[model samples]
Target chain A: MAKTVDAKHIISITVENKPGVLARISGLFSSRGFNIDSLAVGETEEPTLSRMTIVVKGDEATLEQIRKQLGKIIDVVKVQDFSGLDFVERDLALLKVNAPAAKRGEILQIVEVFRGKIVDVGQRHLMIELSGPEAKIEAMIALMQPYGIKEVARTGRIAMVRGVK
Target chain B: MSKKSKTSKPVERGREPKTGSQILVDALIAEGAQVIFGIPGGALIDVFDALYDAPLRFILTRHEQGAAHAADGYARATGRVGVCMATSGPGATNLVTGIATANFDSVPIVAITGQVPTNLIGNDAFQEADITGICRPITKHSFLVKDVKELARVIKEAFYIASTGRPGPVLVDLPRDVSRAVCEGNPSSEISLRGYKPVYEGNIKQIRLAAKVINDASRPVIYAGGGVIISGASEQLRALAKKAHIPATTTLMALGAFPEDHPLSLGMLGMHGTAYANHAVMESDLIIAIGARFDDRITGKVDAFAPHAKILHIDIDPASISKNIRVDVPVVGDAKNILENLIPLVEPAEHKEWLKTIAKWKKDRPLTYSDTGLKPQYIVEQICEATKGEAIIATEVGQNQMWAAQFFTFTRPRSIITSGGLGTMGYGFPACIGAQVGCPDKIVFDIAGDGSIQMNIQELATAVNNQLPVNVAILNNGYLGMVRQWQELFFKKRYSHTTLTGSPDFSKVAQAYGAEGRLIEKKEDVRPALEEAVASPRTFVLDFHIDPEENVFPMVPAGEALDKMIDGLA
Candidate 1:
């Protein structure tokens, strides 16, 4: 059986901020069919350099090709999949779960296990803040469906390498 | 005046008065434009009349959309701005989708639209439309010519803006009065504009830093993007990769940057990327991104994406360097020119160990899919093998697109012309029309999906009329495969209106247009059908009844990483 697994592949690439570079990268993605998930970019310390964090979800085969292409770009500095390494990946999610006094305890216990904190406690609603892995947050949302999910504010996912050294 | 009337010789020597239509033809010829693809309209009668007498070549298409698409083909094929003229109202509106298509893909196109008489500008006159305003967002620039004297200059400006900077479509709306007016100016004279200035040179300081970083990193991977192809730097990229011994991967648009069969070539990257290609980028210490942007599909999860590597992004657009994914070293210049300079500065390394590791990863899991059922892959494979992997292909959007991307092994640049940026449904047929127009010597195939082909099916008439023959291989899955794939994965296969059960008989349709059309039911017939189609003197449309339920494997279910692909048909 061909087993397919999805993972977050993050890279902190640095490059000179010039013209047509984006078109090149975008053209690369489109022509090669590198389907990205969430892509965020910000300027780095140098005025001419910028940092790009790209999130893609595909099989291992796909991720490998994506890394190679991402790295090959003249503007790209580096690409890495920190999932197996010491990288902390988190997605911020805002959940508005319907909460009355009757089942508040059940929801609260579940939120605590997920390390969530209450942002607002209205008469019939409890807005909680949860920041964790994308899958975990997604699972949490699924479990709270019985409690009634009024709204959801998800900030996709952002990652940083983790280490004690 | 009285003396002139009597003197016969001087009176007869006055230059002939040119109609509005004549001026348009004159201006186009002066601009070095040889072709005009468009439909003849009542408002544009004068222009057509003049066009007939002029030296310019005009391809009168059946539909306005076909005309626009033909222009798209002409422009993309020749790397020159293609010109097409249409009347106002229905004629102009019919071209909206094609204009947007060119705009999204950033192709060099010039569209000319006729308008109502000057007196009836604001009123809803017959065959009148506010095309200038209507095409605002869809065009890089648009001009509404109220004065006939400014027609030539406006057209010149339109062409300049379209083909120069990040190529896109531009429109020039000519009112009836303006077309009829006498505007005298040399279209080829030295033109100046204080408004437009596009930067072509790179920042030296940044280029030097980029060179240093690349030289410092031992385990480096070269990631080529579509910019390499757009900038025509495939040779430069090849030179750099060979000299530096840096393994490379390309995005879809960058398919031709390096030969796919090359040992250094890791194949395409992103959702359906090969295991080795993604692993090399993930594991490498330094990533040299050339002319590619950091798209969301390529990076599964940013924090974890290529954590071990440092990125050096080179692009022509300043905003793209750090717009989506940040880069450590930003080199903004033309990909070809920049790579040419950087290749000489870097030290060549054997890196056999690193290359071996990547090869090991590649072997661990080749992009394998079983021919277990009736799917587009079967057909795509046959096409590749039949063409000996040396044919130019244009693909329409949907499952057929995915199949082509996965199964086709392209070895050169511009070999595959598909709508990657916009994913326009009907893009395959029109794009192939353009590709074939550009490279008629090579056997060109339009790998189309049933749903996508219907979007521009009218082009068959244009194909037959113009005698620009191309083989159209339709993977008739009876659904908008891409959208259906999405619904199956995310929406639990509710199977909305995406499914198409009984479409118009493609063979009958093709025959009606005076072209050969073949319908293949069994797998064995694919190759034979392909051969017959290619052998035909005229354009051919081969429709295959692929399994509608067949799904493209190696799919990354919406918010997952590249490694987490969903295998098998859903």
Candidate 2:
């Protein structure tokens, strides 16, 4: 069987801030076998509404299906697929990596180049915060891997479409 | 707040104080709800109290499942949102199957379940269940009403959401405290939800393109489904088919959308579909799917289904268009609107060669069975003849359902109700009661298999008590007929637990329920038994001892193409 090539898609949905709405949305994705690469949700400007940014990997047809299915949910206010749009995408990562006094200088140099900040410091580790596009975050993590990374916590990608168009 | 003012005007527009339950009743009545089928429970006592003097008529069903299926039947019969209600916990849980059944078949029904008090909701109070959460997947939408002010709006929204676009079941969980609370204000009648706008008009470009495809195809077939009935597009579908001179096939849900007796009608197409219909679909150069999702049963072996055809799918739900089978053109809108738009652009063309080929196939392999002792097919055929094909026939899932779909010639929309998507057993009897209730003057019959009927047979009392003249024709083969058929073919006749040798006599059961009952074992008794049931002023059950070894023919084993149907008892 010939398979359609899968592509990464960033979909944002605004929904009513009610219990079980998240379960309904996420359940639909999981039920249809659509893999969620990353998901981030928070309250929108309207206190009664919540916005969810979901990154999924699927073919164009499958993504279109997901978008339409999402639109069908009563609580979902709007679903926008930013896969084909020029958007500002960002991911925030908190890395607690092992950094001795000698290695701390090397890690600091890499963090400085990536525009990261040291949020906390321990006797044997430094917790660095990095905020950027997924690619930049990936690069920063890769460079910090040699410093004997101990722990990593990352917020999934969130996106906003560029200016009025 | 004066006592004199309250006493003088009990229900003054905005001055009188009404309980939350009163507002709920008023909201339902305002939404054009004629009747509700449900059972009362502890959590729903206040709602029932409010309903006691309300304008609505409530049919207290024996079981919550019966209430739900009855409501589903009402919705399918009338094309209106059917309403069913029950209290929390077991009462609410019993409605789950019926809700799923309605959901699977896209029947518009609003199920209102009573919950524990607002503060006690998460604590799992007596008779409490997280019904909204439990019903999330099965409902089009669900609401947990905590505040009295939101009750009216939520009810209105539930009706709106259930009846729009691709219709399905919606649930509203009303907490006991909310229903009992007193609200001084009038419930709002208006609904403004930003997220729920359904597109009803097809794209002009796509409509035109579809018309062109229809006009140019050499072997075009119009495959219609339940959406045609939901959108009331049967007339438009017939017009398009007639104008384009195209043969049409309907799914199980779309049985009556196209006249089965028409020259262009291919009775049904799929697993239990007619041989000619399946063959026509297989050989067609173009398939214009109007409102029909290419369900797995309809499109046997998706990759090989209509392999030679260029598909055009028109439906109200955009999600259903290319969800199953790939299509060359997709039209997302109401079926009626799209069909109306496409009919004008369609050019009249005669497919003489194509029609000739289909006619030959029809003549070569007609749906037939040998005249044997009390055959189920014979009973279904007799019923069709006796009713003149006008009776509202609901069937339990299995051989009986297949036989009804195959043997009965349906001529009008909403005439045949069966669980198509869910293939649920125990759906027919309660649904029969609902259909009879909705269409009081129409003759209703539940063509049931012995095994399937027993699943919800207790509803016989509900039918009898309501004085509904519902005729239940049980095809008793002493086994779960369809599963047994599969066992015979695939499981080397092991039979397993398919046999129901100890099953009670359905006729006796009907008699026990204070309804008319008859047992027939001979072929000659079929017509008279049916005639007797039809003429009876009360509910009747006619149990026919059909041949145990019989099977639904023209079987296309799962995962095989339509053309590869294994015909006959081989």
Candidate 3:
């Protein structure tokens, strides 16, 4: 029943900014075999503190278990499943694909359709830039595969609650 | 809850005023802390007052080091960030080593230290030191909260960073005045940083490229590392291996990624790894490295690791790719995703010649072990079989660790957990707690040595109090076996302080912790004791007093060239 889903669950947890606190939180999730989703950490309004916004995906039970276990972290003050809340999720993708003279126009056309901008064009290659949910970017990249893609780099999903609670 | 008032117990003479500490304690409990592990300090008496009335259970330990380790144990055991508190100066420094150990092992822990009063701070005053600076290198992040208003928010963020990507340890330092200052209700806020974006998904092109590589590889070998275990990709690894017909070998940290007994499975590779395994690497033309970096231990002479093979390294961290060894194709992605894409790329290639070639190497240089007087191999085999090979075996790093890798048949990936990367001596017990927490149905045992067991023996109490069923199998060789062997071979047998002669009775120690403890005096008693230990409802410790002079052979000396191995028994 353990399966890897495509959508990485995002969790926003609040905690005291103290020593060894990070280890405690990560240890909990790691122990449960929940690899962290995209992790973005920074200080909150309090100068002495910080906040960790994480995204990871697992089964319903695992996600709940992860949340419950996170409560045990010594420095953690709160755990929230931001993905389940009203939030905006976005990801960035950069792809390197071959662009022949014959296909250059078609490639540019495809890029514009995906709202992707042409970032670079070297000898016989085109680099496209796009930002959105993971699946949309993936679909765009898949469409460009037949053109003999050279390389693709992506920033995993990062999200925020739509309306700040 | 204890109906204790703040003023019920009078503050100690050297303590600060009660009102300030009460405020600190109230804020801590408001943050939902159930218990804390730490020691008291002279300057933080005000915080203690708050702790008394807040219904928080504080478990005091013998030393700050023990407190931190205890917190680490709790974190690992409960899947939570373990918290430890200590006063400034020596108290904070005492927690440093434990914090570093947790960092190395990737354990989530939160440490709190009480600094000297704000006015008296940084004056070389009594019991003051720059703990933040000293711990900066060891912690994921550190904090110094001068104002009490920031304490709540600081603690909130500490938990967040600790549990996030690639979990590690973090520290929070509070001055005496800060802990006492009154803070408003929970300081709820958002976090925004420019530098902290963790990548979760794999690159689509890289996934396709990995697929293409698998499709083209005539003699491909899959090398898995600890990240596979961390990401829980054993099932996906197996699916990819079976679909692609690629032989799989695991790095030390990824022992359980694929079934050890699989036909396409080659045992561990590297310096001390089986000769057949190393030969397979040299013979293969393609190496698909998954969730593993090319560490020196795995790739003996780096330049020669896979000279003939075109290496495809896929990892979560981009820096890990081509960090140690070179790579032809670098895929920055999760192991499971990459494997999923590769499955479709495998075109049913019944490459008989490649399989036969690898088979020849396996037959010529098969792994071997002997059954001489009181063979530890026999003990390992019996226990593994007795537990149906489903047990999560934890080993103290060294020869026994390698021996366990060599002998034990692991059918399930992630079943055999150990201190692979760090090779820490005291990691066995606490890691077993973590493993047990992860897989409650499996038998979790820490196979320890006489020397390694004593490193963090106090964890026995944690296990006992929590009622976690774990077995401690001590292979009492009376020495730090690995170091002793090195000395025996290179230093003309001038054994240093490695010998553990006339140590404390481990059985009595176990008894003190309210658990079953047995001493295996005779060789025949070993199996029965093992069975009894595994079946016991409580924590069990089996101490086997073994021959002091025995040694584990097949050692590869550090920095002495790959072939300069002193493997007499091999």
Q: 1 or 2: which has the higher TM-score?
A: 2
Q: Model 1: runs farther than 4 Å from truth?
A: A1-165, B1-20, B184-189, B300-305
TM-score of each: 0.73, 0.97, 0.68
Q: Which 10 consecutive residues of model 2 chain A have the lowest summed lDDT? A: A1-10
**lDDT measured at residue A91 in model 2 versus the true structure, 0 to 100:** 97
Q: Write the per-residue lDDT of candidate 3 for residues B1-570, one digit (tens) a residue.
A: 134435356545644433445545554565555567788897666677667667877766656776776576556544467778899899999888778877765667888888887888779988898787777656776777776656656676677667655566878888887776755333443443323444557778877777777788788888888677656678988888787678888877678778888988887877667666666677778898988877778887665566678888888666566656767888776777666766776676666777798788778656665555565666778789879888888787776687677778877765665655556677677667645544567788888888888887887876777677988888777788888888888899999988778888899899988988898867788788888888887899988876666565444466543444455564
Q: Which tens-of-lDDT digit does each residue in B1-570 have in candidate 2?
A: 677546653664565677889888988998899999999998989999999888887887888999999999999998888999999999999999999999999999999999999889788688888888788878898989888988889999999999998999999999899999997556575786888899999999999999888888999999999999999999998998888789999999999999999999999999988999999999999999988899999999998999889999998888897888887999999999988888989898889999999999999999998886778888998999999989999999999999999999998999988999888899999998998899999999999999999999989989988899999999999999899989998899999999898888788899999999999999998999899999999999999998989999988888888888888744
Once fitted onto the true fold, the runs of candidate 3 whose alpha carbons sit more than 4 angstroms away are: A1-165, B1-85, B346-351, B413-417, B433-442, B465-468, B512-514, B547-549, B560-570
True contacts kept of each: 0.00, 0.61, 0.00
* lDDT (tens digit, per residue) of candidate 1 on A1-165: 123687657655555465444554555677678776766566777777665666777776566566655554434555556657678777789999999999899999999999999999999999999999888898999989999999999874667777666
**Most DockQ-accurate candidate:** 2
Query: Each candidate's DockQ score against the native complex?
Result: 0.02, 0.61, 0.02
Tens digits of per-residue lDDT for model 2, A15-115: 98988889999988877788999999999989999999999998878887899889999889999999778899999999999999988888988899999
Model 3 docking tier (incorrect/acceptable/medium/high) = incorrect
TM-score, chain B, predicted structure 3:
0.84
What value does the lDDT take at residue A13 in candidate 1?
A: 52
